[model samples]
Target: MTSSAIIQNIPCTLVTGFLGAGKTTIINQLLATKPADVRWALLINEFGRIGIDGALLKGRQNDVEKPNTIAIREVSGGCICCTSQLPLQIALTRLLSEHRPQRLIIEPTGLAHPHELVKQLSAPHWQTSLSMQSVITVLSGLQWQQEKYRSHEGFQAHVQAADVVIINRYEQLDATCQQDLLTWIGTLNAQASIIWAAPNDASSELTVAQLSMQLNQPSASISKQRATQSSQSRISLTLPNHLLTNMPNAGNSAAMTMDDEPPYRYHDEQQGMLLAGWRLPSHWMFAADELQQWLLQLPNWQRIKGVVHTSDGWQQLNFTPDSLTITTTSAQIDSRIEVILLANTDNSHINSKVSKNERQPLIDWDVYDHELMALLAK
Candidate 1:
């Protein structure tokens, strides 16, 4: 019998994107607007040893009613598409066998390469149980247009592999920048459906099979410019996931495990090294202001995330790529500061790394609160 004849299973939507491309934001928006008749589960990947992303997503479970409204599984240490394909299969099998949700949404890490991922899903084992319905790539228009991202081999792979590309943060770009992006998109995949997004019109969905596939050669100057920009801006930071989730002061909590039966191990054949992660409770939250203050003190901090118990509720703060945002529900007043830090050449704890000008404490909390309330009032 053919592989498709073996399982004859359901279809799954794979949501892939580059770093800082708003994948989580789009996923959340999709779940929020889901018709009451459809059931779905969300699988998330983390590059760190800790699974804070999975924990934060769990909070969404409380907001929906469908038994399969949302189920979160974590793929850690590496990305699901490139470095952890087996886990992806296991997660899908378990979700299907257990929850049997009507749909499965796979959210790969920012660094994940979607083309490699989709190719894996075409394997006989997976083809039987799941159909690769669509590849949804969420992109930040401003960031996508940056000289650094548009030229990367990985970025090219990401854009070329998409069935639908959701252009987010569209309002952040100027008219010229937006037009350039649209033109660039046409060159990348003319058949792919492109959707412009803003907060007011954040909810958008596309059926993958209905889209087009197109690819064009990128200019050499564009590639060189991207390389220069990326080298100057890229930063890396590594931490034991345990520090983010298991700390005594941790707040938001949840339990997470690898769906893989044996729990795959990480090893580097060339370097003869093995990498492993410690499991931390799913609960932890952070205070927005305190977290920002802490980052200012870390000379080498690149990307950081941690669970913190805020006065209002639970939250997780992710700090990386020059920005820190708290992922929390607006319903509760949860406020606390926690994060994971990733560093590059800037990863120094020396006095020279610290600017002599000194700095004032961050008091953006009260200011931000007032601004938020004022906007809400308006």
Candidate 2:
């Protein structure tokens, strides 16, 4: 493909899932097994203001063969399917125009509504240039059993939009639970191709061959929108670069330098969810064990993920109700963490998703900030 030639019919895949569903891990696996001759571009939309997934991906790429062939961009602070659609358009167009990649993979923030996004992506503008393939949604079978997830509209839509569904970590459950979960999924979308996979042991994910099998199925993404639209007033999104990938981060946020900048924090609330993210200066190091304990015990939240500089070295932390995994990492940059919690949370110290006057109390963010800083290495 010549640089001057127009790019069209790029094979595009969207990986949709709920928080902590291991979307990044699966993407990393796909990257490892991607065709050596094909140039692939990845766009990750993050729910938190401080972007960490892009950094995590770039960090792990050191182990990918011919990793230079991959192009990565991120849009953070809002879901790309809605509030940040403009940013998505800008980033997508630029990536295709500049990279002319043979394949495109988009990871929409887990909280986003897939039905609306599919409509927008299949709009007249992108219909001809990009060929939409399978929409893959990942979820643990345990999640399906929880009433909180089963009743959630975003979670349900993700399953409905998927051409292929991956029910990972289901082996951890007993036979009865697994059967009930599978039955529930069938009722939601009887047409989806379901694959059962073993739990990922932190370092690995669904094989490329398995992913390709799913992608081969043509997508029948939900075309009708169901969820209530967020306030159309656009939310600001930040696209940051913590990688030395030769490409610059888009001018999307205030944190200009990852190494030297002081800790930057941003908070956002949408769709009855509250998200917060932080970026600490690179020099700040924490006691790994202590930090892990503190993060795991965070008062009340749905999920927390971070890549940080620890006395034990750079570590990546992923925590959910069912599992907690921490592993060493090769990529280094400003240490950062992101947390997600339900909007009507009972945590008195945290803010709920409500208007200025209706908010419970001026959340004493200082308290949490102090708690985190206290774990810093002496």
Candidate 3:
């Protein structure tokens, strides 16, 4: 196909949400249920250096009846909306050129701002190259009730920029909570279609045609009262060096050390909080009990999610300030974990230490790394 034909025919869907909102789960479901004849390409972006989501999706692909038709690429360490833009463009162009997929799906890091991404995709250069479809934003009703996340600029931006808003984990909400969520979402995006789906529900399949139809309908008008809110509330927090650096023997051994001047940290700032990540080798298996104990003691982190190999099998870890849930999951290509911490602007401890060459001393990397290495050594 000619380049012009490829751009006009391909439909790209952007899936975005805040941390732990089940974005990966939804994407996996969509991929599993996709038509057997259609070729799909997925570009997943993560806030952490380790590509845990990509691994999980690949695992899901293995279970599908026809896995060969799908192609996956991962962009990690920073939000693609800013720091990872060039990488995204290069990867996307390559995926399109190589696969010639009928559809494209992009899952940006939870910390990303969707407006910037939409702007980039809709630029004049890509106008003839790609047709933008419905932008889906997934939300957790329980998290929506939390003042901390509800007030965050990045969360609000996701709501505002979406053409469709999905409320996952809807089964956990009561009638009043559901109504409150709908009301709040309506306030942010009047035009976007809203759908409620249970977490990991196989029936919730998103397709290119469905998204395209939704885009064609008239949307509700967004209120201008908060037009300036995003700009005013957005704060760009610098990611620590440890999160951007890659381990020397990444997937080869159970443990490894980092090198100096790994990848220069991406400086583009967004509207979200901070992230700290670790990439461990596939051979390292965590003792479930020990990992849980360590996670429980981490009171400073707001959200944590990752896939790790355990003595029993593969395990998935999902943690928040108030809860910790672990379940048996399939093994991934490697073990990786990322924790979302309080923003630098909000925490006095982080704010006081912000400097040009230094990262905020929110968490001690040396001690944390040592503890993780010791845990794996056990």
Cα shift from native, residue 145, model 1 (Å): 3.9
Off by over 4 Å in 1: 1-7, 62-68, 199-290, 296-304, 310-313, 318-324, 327-344, 350-378
lDDT of 3 by residue, 1-378 (tens): 545554554767788898777776667666665677888889988776656667776776666675666888888767777774688777787888877888788899888878787767765556566667678888887788789879888789899998788787667778998888888888987878887664454554454344335433322221121233211111112223353234334342322333412211111223435555665556566677787677656535667877877776788887865457788886666677766665444432333554686543433444555555555523
Q: Candidate 2, TM-score vs. the true structure? A: 0.82
> Could you estimate the TM-score for every candidate?
0.63, 0.82, 0.75
Q: Return the top candidate by TM-score.
A: 2
Instruction: Write the residue-wise lDDT of candidate 2 on 36-105 in tens digits.
Output: 7878999999887677878877654455655567888888778888785688778888888887888888
- Residue 240 error for model 3, in Å? 23
> Best by lDDT, which number?
2
Candidates by lDDT, descending order: 2, 3, 1
Worst 10 residues of 1 by lDDT: 230-239
Error of 2 at 221 (Å): 1.9
As for candidate 3, its clashing pairs are 7-129, 191-220
- Which stretches of candidate 2 lie above 4 Å from their native place? 1-5, 60-67, 199-208, 222-260, 348-362
- Where does candidate 2 have its weakest 10-residue lDDT segment? 226-235
For 225-335, candidate 1 gives per-residue lDDT tens digits of 234431011111112344444444323222122342111122211011112222222232334465456445654333455555444445556655536666554432222
What TM-score would candidate 1 get against the native? 0.63
